[model samples]
Target: MRVPMILALVTVLAGCADSHRWSPQQNGSARITTSDRIFITTPADGEYGDNVYSGSGRNTAKIIYNAASAKSHLVRIGGLAENYQDAINQAQGAEQDILIFPTILHWEDRATEWSMISDKVEIKVEVIQVQTGAVISSGIIKGSSGLATLGGDHPQDLLPQPIAEFVSSLF
Candidate 1:
């Protein structure tokens, strides 16, 4: 009876640790002060797999944009760019001081409730100094839903907290 109870407990708790997680919080200096000229670009696209790149750029970009928008009183978001150099040019042409580049590295949408597969998302943020064309600060925020997710939950649901937390670190 005790062995059966232990097995049940283990099964119930399995994969709980796989819930959303991020690493290496925002580092470096040069915070976005209220008076700095800042610009941002939507990432290109996120790769799903098997030569199928999901056009989740704008959607993912907005997730981060809205999360960081608590400081939106002084920000300008540019349209999607082809690559890093193009984004830099856009920022410089606009005469901006800083450029925020958000690239979606990986995105996987899985049905966790029935399939037990967790959805995944990885975003990389680069804060650039336009004048010098140098990255003043950067961070990568990755998240994944738990293997035991309830129905109707996506990986994106796990983004806001860490995103908001990271944004708050900037100020």
Candidate 2:
């Protein structure tokens, strides 16, 4: 009887684990998306003289996602925009390079289990070089379909993929 009770407890715990998800470590080509011809900027590349908005003088980049897609997208963007700005501010102070204002939209891909498909307008971003007048970088943030199980419908952590990839590209 004790053995049966322990097995039942283990099963219950496993089920609970399935319901509460965690951010997955980025790995595999299918999970991570990268951009070519675009580069990440550093804080040393751009900076302002005590101006809160004054970022590195290099250039500026902005990200925009469709508001109509998922109800969660707005919340995701709000969180990511803050992170992006903070990254820009840090990059400016460190490298003095600023991404140009008015970003670019590469493409948006939706999350799916069997195959990765473009739907739901899940992720989109834009990047530009202000001085040079060039579209420096752009891409869609994406996550694995496996994330759909827990808090599925949409996973908030997947929102950071673009920022992470963009930073990686800069290096």
Candidate 3:
């Protein structure tokens, strides 16, 4: 009985109950490597509601950079912008082999223990070739805090795993 209970717990926390989801709108065929010169642009802040906004574009960039680097994939971040066209222009103007662009759609942080609302994050990531400005891989990533928030959880705290998975998918 103890063994069964432990196994069930692991499945919930570490398996089926994964608090994040990635829906690829477009799957790009960009196999990357540490030798590949990759650049990233900060996504414009996603608008949630009136007077409410997402403030983790740079944070997301850092997360992606760190996660990808951990896998021996190097990435750069710069030319931050809130507009898609502007970001494209900046990336196209730069001298990199590829560009990773991200756009935040939804980001919410709530008191999970008190309000029973989970901290949620939704961002779309795209891989582009610098010269042609063609999208290689694109997907929407969504993450949320589960019943194990330890009271309150930050959206960024739940990003590493999903980001890691996304990065791995590139290779």
Candidate 4:
């Protein structure tokens, strides 16, 4: 009985430490160049909030801004907007040629096994034209952290790599 119990425990622990995989999807075509002026718009209220696993949309926006700014020259970061239209208006007012809007689709923080927890998030990014409000390009970025039991102490750190990967796919 002791041998069986130990084997079961080890199996559970191994399952919890399993590797994670991510798949990002893209749609439409938005041409991004080093010289283009860009604006990052925040999501509306209730779109993304401080839940158990999910951070605020503002946090996601900041991550996206940092990633975009690293590649583009002219980039503006704005506060939370009422809706997508409001974001476009803000971008237009800023005299930006393009707008990068991010929406948090899903967030999960759960224990895969006993005490091992994992953090996952899905962010959809839309690139639109400020003048016509036409969607030039869009993509969904999905990412997960390695198994740990820290209770998401540093969720912000998990986002940069996925955001950078998605941005690289733009051009």
Q: What is the C-alpha lDDT of each candidate?
A: 0.75, 0.32, 0.76, 0.69
| Candidate closest to the true structure, highest lDDT | 3
Q: Output the worst ten-in-a-row residue range by lDDT, candidate 4.
A: 15-24
What is the C-alpha local distance difference test score of candidate 1?
Answer: 0.75
- Deviation (Å) of 49 in candidate 1: 1.7
Ranking by TM-score: 3, 1, 4, 2
Q: What C-alpha lDDT, on a 0 to 100 scale, does residue 133 get in candidate 4?
A: 77
The pairs that clash in candidate 4 are 29-136
- Using all chains and alpha carbons, the TM-scores for the candidates as numbered come to 0.80, 0.30, 0.81, 0.71
lDDT by residue (tens digit), candidate 4, 1-171: 999999988875654442323354445655778888889887642232455433456788888888888888688778776678888888988898888988767665555334455666676778887887777777666655555333433444567877777776665
Candidate that beats the other on lDDT, 1 or 3, i.e. the better one = 3
Task: Summarize candidate 3's per-residue lDDT along 38-139 as a digit string, tens digits.
Answer: 778887665556635545777888888887777665567886776767777776666677778888788887777667677888988888777777778899
